[model samples]
Target: MPLPGQQSPLMIHWEASPEKQMDCQQKGKNNKTECFNHVRFLQRLNSTHLYACGTYAFHPLCAAIDANRFMLPSHFEEGKEKCPYDPARGYTGLIVDGGLYTATRYEFRSLPDIRRNLHQRPLKTEESPLHWLNDAEFVASVLVRESRDSPVGDDDKIYYFFTERAGEETTSFFDKSHVARVARVARVCKSDVGGKKILQRKWTSFMKARLVCYIPYYEVLRSVCSLDGGGWASTVFYAAFTLSAQWRTMEASAVCRYSISAVQRAFEGPYMEYQDSTRKWARYDGAVPEPRPGSCITDHSRRKGYNSSQDLPNSVLDFVKLHPLMFEEVKPAGGEPLLVKKSVAYSRLAVDRVQALDGRSYDVLFMGTGDGWLHKAVVVGSGIHIVEEVQVFRDLQPVESLVISHAQRSLYVGAASGIVQVPLATCARYTSCYDCILARDPYCAWDGRACRATATMDSTGLVQDIQSGNKGCRSISGRGSLPWKNRTVLQGDDVLLPCDQRSNLARAVWLLNGSEVLGMGQDRLRVGVDGLLVTDTLPQHSGEYRCYGEERGLQTLLAAYSLTVLPEIPRSPTAATPPHAASQAANDMKVAYISAIVTLVVLCAVLSTILLYMSCLEKRKGKYVLGEPRPSSVELQTVSANCLRKGHREEEEEEEELTYPDGCLRIIPGEAPTAATSPIKELPVAVPPLPPPLPAELTNGMGALPNVLRKMNGNSYMLLQQQEEPLVSPLYSASFTEELSKILEKRKHTQLVEKLDESSV
Candidate 1:
């Protein structure tokens, strides 16, 4: 897709050849999902064209697309070695000087190889039992221009990042889960060609070293984002890593930064040789070859009568083929990760260098999570502070790719749904100087009026403190304040004050008068998700309530409210009443007292008469008991049988209502259960059994008793008649329903849990 200024976006759809699609379908591949064109590699070839390739239904194809028209030609080149046949494979490539350098799986069952294509004579890594690449997953590739102003006039180099498994002997149960796989950084000279004779059509300047991070149990590389400093000596790369599958039980990830000079030194160190007898890799201490086996063709090498790799001697080429691994491991710059996060797995990374108002360039990292969130952070001296987080996708899909545009100040995010364009300079979200400063974002600054983008405005009045966030903003005038909202309520009534925070990194703190409220309380005061709720309002609570946003110990007022509690008026009569009114009131009270005594005496007499009659009746009929009557054997047997039938019917209904193959729980009110619709159904209940039959002796012998009295005395019929519906289990009613509600809430702004203890809900 192309977005031309003031014009509709243009989209060019590419389809696979019908013959290839049919072949893939016949081989047991899914026709709807697998046998389709999926573009995997796209890079700019020149000013007006782009080099692109795709998995054309298992037959790889490449084409040259016109940049202006966004269309491709009919003819395409065979991309068997340059692109992978499977779109799901890990492939990384770059186009430098019209030559494509790629690391990909060339065939269906062959090992992955790194090759240089589109050259006069294509060259690739040697296929040997030493296993140069063993189950490797490529992450990224970058070209470092070292030919400009080089002290030794060294050739340009292309670097590749990946993670691969170790040798077979070192993959025991204890080692495989901890140290079986290690991240690698490999490089090759751009001007290198095939060797003379020993290793024809193969690279002679290939060398790889281990990339080490200080994080424990996180050695696998997931993604890499590089920053070019206009010189190879100053370039740096930021990589994200996670734990291996066997040790991965929590959502934890880390980002480490490495310098190019550190990686270069590792490549120049000792070589690691694989010993056949021991089946292990160790540092080589053998004879050294002239011109150093894996060294690039520099001025000193040219002076030794070797102008190109093809002119190298047989001895040097043989040494290069045997020892391609470096001994020294390249460690990260601070001996620690730039940031280690828990409960979030970062999948993609992008860095943007911004020149702040203070004239210092800062690298702002944009990290994408597996659950469709984007975290923006800035480097502050030796530490990092997260500015904010934004949800880029409505669905919880992993972020696939990220691209940053410096000219437009926007970041492009790619996921399963589609592409999302987010602005890099969202300074307007920070309303106060303290919030803007505490954020430490280089692209934003406080301009004495409001937080604004530093790129578009000048630095005359802009204030930014990227290192130390404390800029004495506690007394700053008009610091993100709102007008007081007057609220009047009667005594003992509850009141709510509204305050909404936009940043998840900051916590909202409520202040009564001038002192801060202690914690989110439950008695008479508390902080809810919407705002501050105060119950049982009194005159003491009638004061100014201000909500301040605090982050990293800095505070900024967000909202304010004024409350007034009115006292109740008296309703009793005063002393200025007339004499006639008092006399009337006294006479009324005396008559009321006499009526109450008469009523009490009449009710007491009725109770005594009833008690005497019940005693006399019990004595007359010796068979009648005072407590509840017992059921006969016939009634007990009938109730038990009915309960057993009801249990069976409930089990069958439960089976029908709980059929979910995809592990997603869905319930809809007033909807019937079906395979294609909802899965909630009300289990049928057995009707109350008819009243138990009267005892035969009571009906036949009690002729003097009334008809209603005889039936009531025969059995406890009321106990069987009263029946209510059963309550649903809390596991299905509350927990599962809450999960379904969260699924629906994802369409809006998804709430993220912060690491702070005092953050507002």
Candidate 2:
């Protein structure tokens, strides 16, 4: 296989990229074995060396590893069947002391070669148990019983789990059942590594048994850890199953459990063999091979100088390959599941056995699903059920593997994109008893302030003791000295009474005046964001308000408060005014405004009338001036002395020449000198004091005196003619013409002045 002369071929290496990465990049190089497919992590034996393989690589390199990295000599690449490079192929394997034992195809150049040190694949016979692997998926593998566990220094044995098609389908070409099951356990001994000639480098004791209730839909639902009953006599394996797109098995998905005890029994029972006469395989009951092929080899074999399968004969090895499968079908532990669920295809699983407050133990299973949700389930009475489902992957990436760290109370789930670290339980968020009880998780218990996980317990069934509410803080915590809650709001303003509650399951009750508050749908009073709200606070609203939490008909005083409504302060005058005063002022101004306008108009008219009347009276008074009287044709007669004396007989008569305003006065000789005896009633006019008397011939004889005509002291005006008066023409008193002064002098408040009429000559 090496270049004829060389001892072994060399693997070129550098710090650059791996050679396999280039294989996938080549355009013309189209081969399935060109690149590495699966990688199984082996241990680092030392600082300089480790064991690994680029399973199904172009050169089939093996036993290669390093931190920076290195490749082993090509000579260790025993066969291509050990590790395939194609991604579509799958296998379960382990490495120890440079020897590899696995359940994989035994082939070279696409041809079958059954004479290998390990033979995990079954025959193609319709009745063969391994015949199911024809179209099956290999789930996972792990070492079960090691040589150190045996006091006699026995060989190491590994257990493999998988799922395959049912045997009935192998017989019918068309009639096939889609239903499948968990192909439980298959084992191969370490010492069975083949020796030189017959069955060389092939397994001598490879056998398979059924494991109960495991989901084998995946190629490898990796096994993190196993729980053992003391040693290997009884054990359980926890696994996750994902619903594949190619097949629809169940409407919902689930996580399944398996037991090693069931698998061991299935391997020790009768084997199904082919009956040539009937052309069918029947259950074999005649004889079983000696040395118990599936059992571990004790030190007694070593005492007989037998170490590996190479020490055994070819006839015994040939018999083992023919009967690789046992007859009995396995069942799950307790005849039921530890945890089961639906609607979520669980693809990866990690489990922990924990103690609860009820003094009982429970298995807490963390299962990852294809839908990106992580389901947490617990083992409860006769069945497994989900406690809660959490969304771990926001982007919906598929979960490929899972790892648990019990010390940190976390599970690390890995995907192609990244890994997420999730806590086993987040108990602090649920602080109330109603919230804690409804969660139904075994790890959480409501403490005084939060939901806490308690690890110390003396009894087995102690999980059921958790029940309490997160209220009545003063009483429950024994610290009632806390200050009283108080609130104040102005009247007619919206107010919110706060009662912040942390528990989602508990109902908050608001109390006002020692009675229940109205429900949320009411106006003015309602349950708002923080707690209760009085949309409009009034003076009557000032009272004690309280909030309580109710759970299981039990009450807890959550908070208490004294609410006081302050009276509203008045606003400034610019903002508000008395309505009554404002209306009265407006009315008064309206009336006064109208009245003043009317009085101004009337006073102007009255003043104008009085001025006109005064001007006319002055003009008419000028006409009454006798000093320049117009020449009248009427005859005047002088009164005799006897007549004047007789007219004045009743009074003391004086013979005095009285010069009157003779310009208009005329007398009749036969008439008495009184005003009533006169035929014409003359109008009286204003007169100034007489200046000097004139001759009787030059003026009318009558000198008049009327009570209606009054005299002023000397201030006067009159109509006087400005003609040259001849000295002999009887010097008349020219200054006394008789034009009235301003028509009427200022009159007294009670004065009644006589009216004068206009006249024409």
Candidate 3:
């Protein structure tokens, strides 16, 4: 028998040989080789049930037996014995937290009896006599595995699922018991032993519905493997089957997936409830009420208005309608039950099928069937095409498990007999050679004769050369066969070296020292694929080139190419330099030098132009001119005053003088002279006399002018001397003064002004 860690029975033949093993050890010690074992097979045991003395393994048998043992007794003692719910029937028969536990029908029936019995006598078990579950409640049935569905959890609780037995008249008569009813999965802890007889918490019912009608009737939940090294937690996938009563009718099946997060929510509380607004006792919330320790209520009157905390909302009750696999309805050719790959297989194997380390996608599938057959399939457009099917066993025993060794490119199949190894590439048509080589995967290349690396000989040599260069400073020289052909060429003949552009240039050299090459120098020797050209091949130009290059940073030499000058050269001697070639070369050199100098001069000129343009721009934008004096404030003020005086004189001249209506000068007419007796030519005085007595209305408020006039009324001689001077006419132009006499004669009030003047005198 193979040990738990040993590779299964079939892969034993693929083990390494003693010599190869010794070589591997020696290589490891010497550090000469990086050993990669491509072929590896591992067999991992399903020891999840071994904990708790394999209680999960024994639960089914125990439940089956317990059902029979308690069936008749429970029926007989019905109301008299008050049979408690069976606790053992609810055992989940799953490996949880590294232990195996179970709930059975007998345990559910005996729960109440056990609680009562606990008060009288201590409950004891072989494993631990003082073990007792704490804060436990029996919500609903936790057992009854109809579709081989197991719900596993880390907490010390087990759940049993059962459905109400349907009436015989219903279509789903046999499936009556398939309806799902969940209960709190619990276990007695060793620490909580002998503390309390009654549990603090009570089991609360959440969702309950007929089983056959629900889309996904069964689900198996397993722990999710953590890539971050966290311990396993629950992730669930379900397989459901829908059957029809008609004979030979095809049954549809699907694999459904559910996230762990969804299940945790469903288990938190009851999912449906009925609230009565009128009565407080009838109104029940969805919380699990505290359990009364030792009290047993037997009266119907007291329980009539009693509210139970097991009511749930209708929203969570609809979870049964959500099916994860909505499209997996078609059946394969085989009439086998639909099998869902485990979560681990989906995460590791299926994911690895598509993604290789080279960042390329592979359309491959490795299907390990229960019938000891390994089926290889590749994903084509929209469908999967089966490539090969290999039967590793003669008998039709199912393959218990399967694993892929990516390092080796091998598949390990575990069966009842043992384990077997199959090369993955051998089943594919294109041989998967490139992938194997590029990946440097463990599986070696087999070419019908021997196994070797799939890399080309040249590529291998190149890689080896690279490695060799890294080891020391030695140069790599071209080997035995030149790997090139020699050619003798005539004048003007072109030679080509079919080398990649990435190839070393220094490795190529020609022996032209003997030839009188005019422009030959270390820098002037142009190297390219078109082999070295010595125009006008002279007789002395025939030689070989021991090309040199740096390989992996070290200077190295390449193969030599021999050249012989042909006697039959071109008739025109076209290989010789042109007649103007020297002049052209000199002109080109001169042009290049001139261009450099011109560029420098142009650059300087451009800079100078820029500076001059900037200076001109600044001047235009308003920079001060040199040697120009600015106007002073005193000068500005004097100019402004002169302008104001000129404006005032013009304004005064423009004003028209007011004349008396009589058109006569009223200036002291009695004392001086009338217009008719004016002195000499009677020249008009540029002024007019002020006459006329002040109106009483005008002098009504003026006491000074009235008093002066009253005093003057008594003395004419004094009044004549006291009379005011005449007012002047501002409108009369100096040139128009001669025309004033004719204007004064046109008025009739001239005499009144004379009389008023005489009265004043």
How does each model score on lDDT? 0.74, 0.53, 0.31
RMSD of 1: 19.9
Worst 10 residues of 1 by lDDT: 702-711
Candidate numbers sorted by TM-score from highest down: 1, 2, 3
Model 3 misplaced regions, further than 4 Å: 1-98, 102-195, 198-247, 251-253, 269-355, 358-761
Expressed as tens digits, the lDDT of each residue in 680-719 for candidate 1 is 3333222222223333223222111111111122322121
What is candidate 3's local distance difference test score?
A: 0.31
331-363 in candidate 2: lDDT tens per residue?
A: 666765555445556666777877666566667
Off by over 4 Å in 1: 1-9, 168-179, 472-502, 507-510, 516-545, 559-761
Cα RMSD, each candidate: 19.9, 32.5, 38.1
- Name the lDDT value of residue 410 in candidate 3: 68
TM-scores for every predicted model: 0.70, 0.50, 0.26
Highest lDDT scorer? 1
